[model samples]
Target: MNLVESEYQMGKSKIFMRESQKQKLDTQLHQTILSRIIVIQRWYRTIHQRRHFLNFRAMVVKIQAKHTAMSI
Candidate 1:
């Protein structure tokens, strides 16, 4: 941490940074949270789509089975 003397202050038990540093930290935290949310959303969409495809395939199979039984 490059603490310029003017950019920070050291009190008896606390260290304070300038507004610019605080803003930079806030931006980084928000970006990290948003990236994690994107990953979770992508994973959930993949699982939901796969389940929907499986259901559709099962319905098609059932329809084919009924058609074959009627022919027999």
Candidate 2:
């Protein structure tokens, strides 16, 4: 099965698993959760980095304009 199906299956199994068996499932679930968390974190980091770069460019343009105005 694909990733989505596997995740769904694991989730359903987790709800029905006995307490003793839960630990094993918990480990598997944690791995999946951690990986997904990393993906999300990386995505947000990229977005923030791009925004920072754009803001820096805008600031540079404003500073250059101010200097040009002072010179003229």
Candidate 3:
């Protein structure tokens, strides 16, 4: 079957499996969680980078306008 179905079967068979099977399942679960967390962190990093760039641009514009006003 599929990954989901396989995982479901593993869950249902938990009481019958050997120690090795349990460890394997746990390792798979950990890897899945870690990968998802990495994806989320990368997504947040990109969003923060974009926001920082926009803020920097805004500050630059404000500073230029202030200098122009002072010169006028």
Q: Sort by lDDT, best first: what order?
A: 1, 3, 2
Candidate 3 global Cα RMSD: 4.6
Task: Identify the leading candidate in terms of TM-score.
Answer: 1
Model 1 CA deviation exceeding 4 Å by range = 1-15
Q: TM-score for all predictions?
A: 0.75, 0.60, 0.69
lDDT of 3 by residue, 1-72 (tens): 123333333455464555566677888989999999999999999999999999999999999999999999
Candidate 2 structure quality by residue, lDDT tens digits, 1-72: 112333333454454434545566677889999999999999999999999999999999999999999999
Output the lDDT of residue 9, model 3: 39
lDDT value for candidate 2? 0.76
User: Candidate 1 on 1-72: residue-level lDDT in tens?
Assistant: 444678778899997989987776788889999999999999999999999999999999999999999999
- TM-score for candidate 3, residues paired by index: 0.69
Question: Candidate 1, residue 42: CA error in Å?
Answer: 0.5
**Cα-based lDDT at residue 23, candidate 1:** 77
Ranked by TM-score from best down, the candidates are 1, 3, 2
What is the clash tally of candidate 2?
0
- In candidate 2, which residue ranges exceed 4 Å CA deviation? 1-22
What is the C-alpha local distance difference test score of each model? 0.89, 0.76, 0.79
